[model samples]
Target: MITASLESARTVLSEVFGYDSFRGEQEAVVEHVVAGGDAVVLMPTGGGKSLCYQIPSIVRPGTGVVVSPLIALMADQVAALENLGVRAAYLNSTLTLDRVHEVERQFLDGELDVLYMAPERLVLPRTLDLLGRGSIALFAIDEAHCVSQWGHDFRSDYLGLHVLADRFPGVPRIALTATATRATHAELTERLSLQDARHFVASFDRPNIEYRIVPKDGPRAQLIDFITTEHPGHCGIVYCLSRRGVDQLAEALNARGIAALPYHAGLPQEVRAGNQARFLREDGLVMVATIAFGMGIDKPDVRFVAHVDLPRSVEGYYQETGRAGRDGLPSTAWMAYGLGDVVSQRRLIESGEGDEAFKRRSMSHLDAMLALCETVDCRRVQLLSYFGEDSGPCGNCDTCKNPPATWDATVEVQKLLSALIRLDRERDQRFGSGQVIDVLRGKAGDRSRASRHEELSVWGVGADLSEAQWRTVIRQALARSLVVSHGDYGVLVPGPAGGPVLRGEERVFLREDPAAKKAGRSRRGGPQGRAAAPIELEPADAALFEQLRSWRAEQAKEQGVPAYVVFNDATLYGVVEAKPASIGELGGISGVGQKKLDRYGEAVLGIVSGAGTSDAEAPDREPG
Candidate 1:
């Protein structure tokens, strides 16, 4: 009854998923898995990861079982799949016992094509027994990086997933993740037992999302300016480091009429669920939350992801920032970074309960993030390079537009490094950046006097720079591995990497402190280049685009799903521009599959033909 070929895969992609062709590695991943081969797919978020296996299940002879961590939205995804005329259902805790039995019956009777469940549920003996009763096309492990203890998002339940491999030897298992450092990638492969699987590592670049990092000068006010100016009347996310910051920032934004809601682990589970659902359904609502939120959320229209505080690692930042602009719209990834963030992150790492090696790894991660934030090169290049991918400078980031002012900090850095050496030799101890700065500024502070640091030759040598300038130098030093922030009291010690800079063998260049530059601010948005810019509809088709969008919104609300789930913005642009007046022409459109054309072709043509009419009159079926 089913055909297994590339042609069949293409047909299923167009008809069932409403996609015209396979993106980057989707086709290869699908073909490999459809032929009963394992894979570890390293595509970016919104790189169409779901379709890699979804189509194989359609082309192959059995149902595909997906293990996902997002318990709340698995039902919504099933709803979306069923909307496309696929026999899909989820077996999670949300279903009643009888309801679960109904789905199970559907599977047993071969009525269901795909079944999604959380990892814990799928690992249960009863669930395994149920799967054993039926022929499984493949086993897809979503968010597979969670199996790595080296990852920040490690889950204990995911530790049980390796059993799936042993239980189903011949079944193809595809492990997928959006974020993985080299180490995490190896850990994912080993922990999930997918060593021989073909690795499909996609380019980890979110080009539609502009990257920005601003000095935290009155961060709250600066954040207000950014949102009110750039992202008014748009849904976005603001991430804070602590639960208290989440609550306070949410309240502050609400007071300013921003319509924000707070979400964190501190809240009750029901409240968190409610907040998440409301964020999904509502328009233009800003969700202020801690990193505890947004692990598995699939909302597609988040216009920006702003950080009031720095995230723990570059991986976390990449994962978090990828949440925005999922619809491929022009969204932003903005953050406010200050020296205090550096100190706080250092303190947390030093005072953390993890073992020494874990703490060192975490500190290394934090240093990578700091390097990203402080880099004068393209943020996109540095970010992708961290994941073992190479890319040129992306003109979309703040660095490309306002290109940071670089100072020849060789002599100044030599002075700073000399001060550290002085502290080690003269004081017979290491001091934190604060005491070092005080000594360098010729200030007789209590600590400086207690340690007799004034007698050192490096004392007062950095007086040519202001206190803030010196702090920036120190921050940049830490970023460049010229200094280390470790020990119990967050002391500054020079690492071996600083030897060349201290000996003047290597020239050091640092982005100048923006505080010194008054006219040109570093935190402004600029024009960017898109990787694949969508073709815009002509002016004559403007009304039609809005009409089509309105119909889409009403239909999405009717179905209790996001608008993008119905039809993406690019597809709508095609419909308006091409002005398809029949099912054949509709099928010619990119997002219009055979199933979609059958269901919504008449509705789309009605919008195209009813030109110059009041768009207030809604169509019965929407054109997505």
Candidate 2:
């Protein structure tokens, strides 16, 4: 049996994980779990949530049975812990029979600190029997939001997890997730039967990520420019709405001499795995994928995440964007938004097989997403507000840095509404935005001309405005629910809210079309903003940093692991900034836990003292 106390937790945190202290609610959560209490921790992606449970597992008796959602995540996490000299093992489908038996024997012999398995495997009767025969310190359910049926990354396998509460009675259970709305939070609590558990909700803010949503104008070109100019040769993820889009975008990026890969469910399993492996192991390769990717990624140096299409909900957007800059360096969350994206999302919600309540929930999610895209306020503030947190402007997002201008669009909106009214009243027809805009702009296409919309009084009223400007009008209207998309063709009809606007009871102000802007280096000197500077070192220390990175790369290559598994950029930053001359001094630095200190302390000292034989020809640049 192991001793459990906050003191032991702190010791494990320093000796095993190499952290000097707990961040945010981590200390309280760790103390609670170590004292044999239950907890529900809601922290951001890079908020050091894993330590809350990881420390307690080491402090308490027996192995920690961690139920993760992905095999990739389980493998990656186990590898990382093993590198820290923790006796961690995992049982997943990828393991051979003999390897599985060895892990099981390790677990039964109480030699494992943490044992991980997918939820599917954990729910099996054989697996449960094996767990029943061993000593268990605690049960950790990572990615706890998956239990929420309406959450962005729901999994049916999570429903069976509630059994842990009843089966493992006194084994202190802790549930954790990076993103969740109040409804999802409540659902996670109830579904997982954690009503009595203490809830520790941290701020859902990723200050390191700069949020920017722009009007879609040649979005593919915009993406290319964003990558090449602002984040050239940096690892990133580009999200597309369809597999074909993923394939085409990956090919287009590759054609432009960017190393890019495509990932979606349609690809063969081996192909997807190979692509994912390469993306993890290689440096500066972008992954163009659909929503099927990036649930439990452990990569810490992703520089940016770009979306060519609108996500289904704000929660989904936040979750996906949170994948960037997990190491707390500067990064960007960018999206290309337009009227077509709104219509496409609306059509999907209306044409689905869900019940009325489900459709209503989905539409609510979409409306919130639209509001985020169209908001003139700080995007980070609005995003956090959705999750029931209050904060002032972050001064890091696009709106905070370069606020957009808005114009009195009342006349333009009245003209668009009048055209819709005329078509409905006189012609008994409704049309999509393209046809309606064509009628208003006095450039009636064949479809609009066939309907004789040219005879309408509102036909040529909007001729002064360009089509792109009119699109802004329509998108803002839809965002405000002044107009609603209906039927399979996404035809626009006056919404209930539009009654007040049409009656002149409410004034309309729309954001002016912003000029195409690409993020540039921020004048502010901190890890904040889109082009914020990463860790900076003096000239001599910078050279030392490069040499240290080269040695790390060689070590990772020899071990067949991602370079970060040896030492993340943040750790190396600590090493470079400290410039320790002795092994004891090196071990005192953050992230230089006892295991790593014993393993690489001397070599790090050598690098710092200019005595180490670094593989100079090795890659010197850190993988983004």
Candidate 3:
């Protein structure tokens, strides 16, 4: 009894898009947009947010103008749409004038279904004039968080997008971002002039990624060891903070017999483009790059994301790590942090232009990241909590699975904060954490002697703890908002709440540093320790995994896409475990899209059958 309009929409969803139905709130969002309502969607990465806009764009009468931030993203999206026989084209700086004119002619002739443009290009007078002539369906702003100053990828051009709605009065608009805190979300909505727009906020949990933070003791060697021993033959990204670091790591990885390529802004435009193309097309290649690369990379088979250095903020960290296991595959999010990283990041922030408030906010964010690195609790839960989502302990992160012990650090905290207060009084606020620690430990070094704090009563109170232990306490105190480090005057001061605790009105229990905690062996005395190994596959299942991987490799070769674009390791592992017999059951897996199911479901199921596996379900382990 469905009407013609509804029936046609459903047909497109199933037949063209290869989706049987909408996921989460996608249907409602699509209907709202198709009905010409403005929307602001805050969906997490890999949550199918694209369909919320793409479906409506196709179902509505006119061409959808998708405003994307990255040139690579626009091209990749257009390519994917074209693969589905959707008429899509992009106009960006990369295109020549002749091609731009041709695309414009097509847009005016109604030959395109969706046209993607960068925010910088879309704000142009000529571009706006052409868009006025077309029947504009919707204006979708992807990565909309970039419009806010608080966001990691802030772009001034994005603020100009508000004019699109003003210029084209009747067209619907949607702004989407994967990572945005409540504050950032409010700012984005206001800046985009979407006060009247409907809002869609999806859960920010990425349950499949296993988070781990290892101390940066010989980071390069550890990286080489991890890739070779733990996750051999897997595709991963190694993120560094600098272009020089990227180049060095790439060279080191190549020397160690791993295929790694360097990608950064310093490289020639064409060379960077070529390197990225190669990484996307080849299997088992590691890309060592700065944050400049890998924004709109569609490769889903990235099995790991390792940071050779610390990211500036949690938002940047989450976005970088979220790139892994996008196909809902089991992957590792690993990083190596050390004292030097803390100093380097702080220096970079201090070098930027900002007032007191901006600097304090930036420092607070960095302190939180440092706390995350030093945490002995579940990394996944902690990360989700930062984004305003809460979850029970995820057993997949390193600390949760193998719980670290705790110690009473109430006395130690008092001693450290008191030392800061004493140093502030003595030096008139001209010292950092190291000098404060030195004065407390009663070290007669030149720096401490120059401050004239060696004779203070609290100077040697914390001498009982080792240098490493003091560092841990300082980081924890900072994390708990018990202290703050000022960069301008370079002083360590008590935080707002630190006063009461120093006065003995409050008590705090602290987790022992993981490195200081005792290491135990598994009951069976294996290297994996007492924590149960992530569910292991039987020989037949392992064989099937290899076959699936090989088949994926072949398909990737044919399409010139990463193997993950065909199937992620997690999906392949799920197949080995679930042994789904039909397309319906295969589609039930977390990351199996309808297009992927229709294209490769039977072959995947065939591997299951050949392994003599029945459609048996295994008990789900706490996702570690």
Candidate 4:
């Protein structure tokens, strides 16, 4: 007689996943889902969301049908599962007819543990018929937020996934997403028919990512300095607002001796796929791209995500930045913002084909993003609050690292507001922040001359500060609601708060702009604005880590999968840190599951014992 219970899930986690215990609500979620119940899991990126479904799939009978959105995700996950000695296969357009028949035969014979397929294929009549003929362990709808109309990376195919619950009434379903707002949450539950599913929301904070946004001053140099110093010898991502920008930046970085590749929808499919595979297989590679490249990426060691331009909303920003530091070690979320970004984003919104109501909602999201960028207080509190959660100062963001010095900018703010008002109300002219700054800085450009803005008393009256400093004042004022911001041309009018500040009826405090910025890794007693350096290791261990990586690279090359699929940095670091003397001791470390311990443990022990070579230690095993 066979015996397995919820307790067995714990054993599966340790033996298969190489973890001694579950994190956060993982155990509860796993147990509930394994007990034939549904779930709506809202965990942050890298929060062990996969385990919630994976462990349950193992604990129960039959095959786990995981509905994945991207082929890369399915392939990567299948590679990982196979490395753990689990019987996993994927069906998509990339597969041959013979391969499909073989996999189907295997599943029919009850030889497969998991079957991953895309939503479109899974919902097919033939595919669904095939699944109905066999036993299904469970259904896991991954990236469930794609069903959300308002979420980033919406997929229409996700709409048809609700039929899983209808067609397989007795089967348990678990809908999971790494990013979801309240609106997205409601839509996911309704669209996926997961209303009865138990909900689990973990903390949204990714404290490993150090948030930092700097003024866009000489952006090229700034980016270079940040990458060379803050992210030396690290795999990172640089996000740009435009495809042209991505290509240009990638070229620039390459010219500067940094290996970078551009990725966007504009690139050829084969080229994009090749670049992505190279990035996963290689080390210290940087990918410069738009949002098209990030979703469902399983690379675990992205050390940083730098933005050359601002994102449209805080939700998008959070999801993008969360891509970094997935391994939970220290990483950076660095960005450079300026007035031009605001103007361009506003222009795009107003010029979009959406109706007035949709445009208004878009603008509201942009305004909230501006507020976050200009915030001098706790960024985590502001970010969490936007998502209906409350949090204290996280001390990991730039603002918390070196609190901004607030200065009473009552007079300067009034002058800038007066300029915007005179240009907009009195003259019937709307100018963007750039032109308005010119008027305030006493530089009467052609636009100022044509609009007769130079004739206004507010023009050239506040030349005490430079243009950059005045721009800071204007941006902060807009963030604090002291000035109204709108229109494609950067039209600025008087808000209710603006009138009070302009009438001397209210006070405005602005963060002072530092004269010269110093960019690099954060050092002890170092100047403000440097990033915290990564964890240092002793020379011997560091050398040993490299050797271990070299060995893993060979194994991955043989398996034709990502090097991380063989072993991640954390596991490798643990091996180096512990220097396990025996196979039993090695099994005690995290990430050394029974399957991996059997495959690589002997080889690893030999290297540590100085008895075998990195390349010579590994023995040939059955092909995955």
Candidate 5:
């Protein structure tokens, strides 16, 4: 029976989804669920996570109930599935009463292969009663990390999902998430009542993503340069810390001739929906948003995700960056962090209404994030270690490509601390980073002159160093907790770890920022940060790829779905490389499932046979 079920899974994978073989633990997950066992899956984004349950939903009897938190993405998910010829529908607030009745009718008649519902809707008595009247194949809980109150993006609705196990006696359950620490994983198991389910945790490493974090130096300008030089004319996302920041940055990028749009909860519903739709349907448009955007987006060609400010937690950072490179192509996870980000994040946590334990948890998360930014070691190593995964240096990240230098900044820190202490003791005053840096660099600005900072003994002491260098010192000091920014003004003060450094009892080492280098130059002579294509296509093949993309775009427009729903970029690349001349030959490619072959195979074969070195333009370059 197990062997036959596994064979059925393989058949579903090839015929419906158009993939030849399962990747990683996909086959194991499908087989377990198909055999009526539960599963808890921790696979990274773009790691083909949906297939684990999607394949089982097809091979198993009855409809699969998918409880999801992303109301906005349910339509897109169902649309993608429907394009593959699967019987999928979703129940959400966006549907009219008549449409809702039709969907419920489909579910009761066993017409839907898979059904998606928000957690709130799924937990209601009406919805539960409806499910009881139908034959359920399985229960798949997505974004299971939302159950962890300590984690970022917590949703109260997810806490009620434990009822699934109790209500649906023998129905198998699967909980999946792309980002989770050991703590979050434990909480997910406990909260979802999946203690006895099999656990499948994939590696957290995304080798195709080249991680690059830079100290904030004219951050907006820096971002512009990074986008233009590394990922021009590519689809990407830029995350900001505030709604105001999102709006301003989007305007700036548009002024600079980049097609950028803003998305946040603050926007009107229609505006946000419009911007999101355009981002999905159009190519090469940038979405500048806050943490409110991008939870379960299925767009497969996002080439880069840039952050102009420090994220509050490593888990949040990982989840956001995972949205890029979903096509398994080379992509970039780029961030620009500064001392202000540190102070602001700390202030927000301290000033929150949460109780003591909650405050402490938030602080711990921040400390880990700070360590990731300031580490002189490989960033990938530190990141994976946070998730309890071990890995060696990834040569693709910025640190591995160009390692930074470290030096003993103990004396420098002592000097900076002494100045802060003298000001509080002598003048009974405290100031923020700008004032303190001025005191260190001995810049006699108006505020410094008014405060008589130059009259102190430490005045002109750090004159030998530049303002930028001193700011770097302050940033490293804050990271190490040798100094802390406190109160609304974010005044610098001695931290718990500062006492030893003040007395010369302990030495401090800090990473020295490298000199700025020209953009668009790589270790090799190729263009910097460009994603390497899977196959180096000949000029004729490249033109053929472009033709295929044009055709796919037109299809997507007519169908009102994301282009990847018709066929992802990886599939197109495969088609061009293979130069399949017949329907049978095209069906042999990885993404060419039986449904797609039956639908578009003749059109594809025509493109291939007719694509004999016409002057079609080359496809846009891939970004890293």
Candidate 6:
């Protein structure tokens, strides 16, 4: 059992981790785990989930066994911990046999406080036998959602983790995941055998991330425009769907003088690792990679995450996009999607390996994601709602914050849906969107001639609309549930709601798609003439805030973490607003927990009280 006193724990936490107190339920989680209770933590990406287990591991009686999936993450965590003068090590494929044996000896000798390993390696019979001899303190399963079949990163080896608890029945266990829906959470608990575990869920909302989705047109140029304008000299990831696409895009960006690198499974393992390391170590390096990379990357200053192609599901998109803005400073999540993305993804699902039920579920997820991409409402509200969270219209995303003028497209929608139905009946529902679009515009392409579909009644009915406009109409039709993609034939079929509308018994309301604009141009007309800048704060207060920010950044850099993870903007704003003059006053400010106060309180309060005045004019500071 753990033997450390609360005072000792607090002292170590402040001295080692550079924080005065834990955030949110971190203190409670540490106490519970240290007392040998099982825990399941569902915290957001930047919510300090690691502290819950890390603190207990230090204070608890035996060495902590942390199961992590990514080698990069293990290295980063070990590096950060060692920077704090903590005894931590990770065993993975990257380690030499001698190093692994040495670490095992250290674990047996109770010299190492925390050790990280991949689940695949940890579940080995030899490894399990070795662990059986040690006094296991706690078993932490990081990225625990990988145990769920429904998760995007599901791994078969994760199913073997439950045997650890069976082997060490008395040891405390903590499972943590950065992203999990309600269903995923349920699956995680059951699969990990954490039936009696306490659940700690931090808020999933990311307020600092500004979300944006532009229709895919001239995508390469647009991507170049966006990266150059908004995120110049910043680290970022650009995701592509195919390895070939990754190489081509990386080369293209390089040709355009961007420091871009390509990463995918096709590359040699060492090459991939080198590119990934370069991306992490170098600023302004854009890594164009397939979905395989960046899963557990801990790079905090990533200014943006852009997707040139559509992700498979909303969960995948959300998790990928969440990598940005982790520093709590301004960051962007941008994606360029088109109808072709929907077609290609559906094709992949239909042709992939899975049972019928699984395929259908995958398709449903894709459909929901498509709806989200095309939604005209606040993107954040819709996204949060999918995760079973409620959020007000976030005035930070593209739609809610910058609504474009929309015109009624009911007539255009009716025309497009009608054209789809007429073509289906004429061609026996075998033609794809391209042929359907051609028939609708009365333009007879080679495929249309081969299929002889131009003789249909609706062939010339949509002649007034251009091809782009017609594509928008059909996309909206799918989004509105007036049409669905038939998996077997790869054709558009009228949905249940579309049947009545086709019979003229119901009217459909559709809004015009926003006109394509240059990347980063405000859709709500031009910028509301720049707002007047606020009057300057007293120079002393302004100078103090600047010094505080610089100090925070330096600390974060020294520890190799995102700056906000040390102290968020909200906390800094509190310091500026409240001007706490003492340790007690600093502790009372929001986010200034016990660990933080003890670590930096004296310095911060000194800066606050010393600003522009001698001790003569010092005012009594109030409680937060």
Q: Write model 5 residue lDDT over 74-187, tens digit each, in one string.
A: 888999898889999999999999999999999999999999999999999999999999989999999999998867989999999999889997999999999999999999
Clashing pairs for predicted structure model 5, backbone only? 18-593, 332-624
Which residue pairs show backbone clashes in model 2? Answer: none
- Estimate the TM-score for candidate 2: 0.94
lDDT of 3 by residue, 516-541 (tens): 22222223212221111133566666
Model 4 segments more than 4 A misplaced: 1-4, 425-427, 444-454, 480-488, 495-497, 522-533, 615-624
Mark the regions of model 1 whose C-alpha exceeds 4 Å error after superposition.
Answer: 1-4, 417-461, 486-500, 503-505, 515-547, 598-624
lDDT of each: 0.82, 0.87, 0.78, 0.83, 0.87, 0.77
lDDT winner? 5
lDDT per residue (tens digit) for residues 377-403 in model 6: 899998888888888888999887777
lDDT of 4 at 228: 76
lDDT of 5: 0.87
* lDDT tens digits by residue: candidate 4, 512-569: 7675476466432222222223567776777777778778878888988988898888
Where does model 6 exceed 4 Å of error? 1-8, 404-408, 427-429, 444-454, 486-490, 519-624
Candidate 5: count of backbone clashes, pairs at least 3 residues apart or interchain: 2
Query: What tens digits encode model 2's per-residue C-alpha lDDT throughout 1-624?
Result: 434487788888889888888889999999889899999999999898888888888888999998898896677788899999888999999999999999999999999999998999999999999999999999999999999977988899999999898888989999999989999999999999999999999999999999998899889988987787677667899999999999999999999877899999999999999898887776678999999999888888888999999999998999999999999988999999999899999999999988999999999999999989888899999999999999999999989998989999888888888889999999999999988889889995788778888888887899999888888899999999889899889999998788877888889998887767665343333221132235555668767777877788788888878878889878888888888766667777878888887677767776776777543422232211
Worst 10 residues of 5 by lDDT: 615-624
How should the candidates be ordered by lDDT, best one leading?
A: 5, 2, 4, 1, 3, 6
lDDT winner between candidates 1 and 4: 4
Off by over 4 Å in 2: 1-4, 518-533, 536-542, 612-624
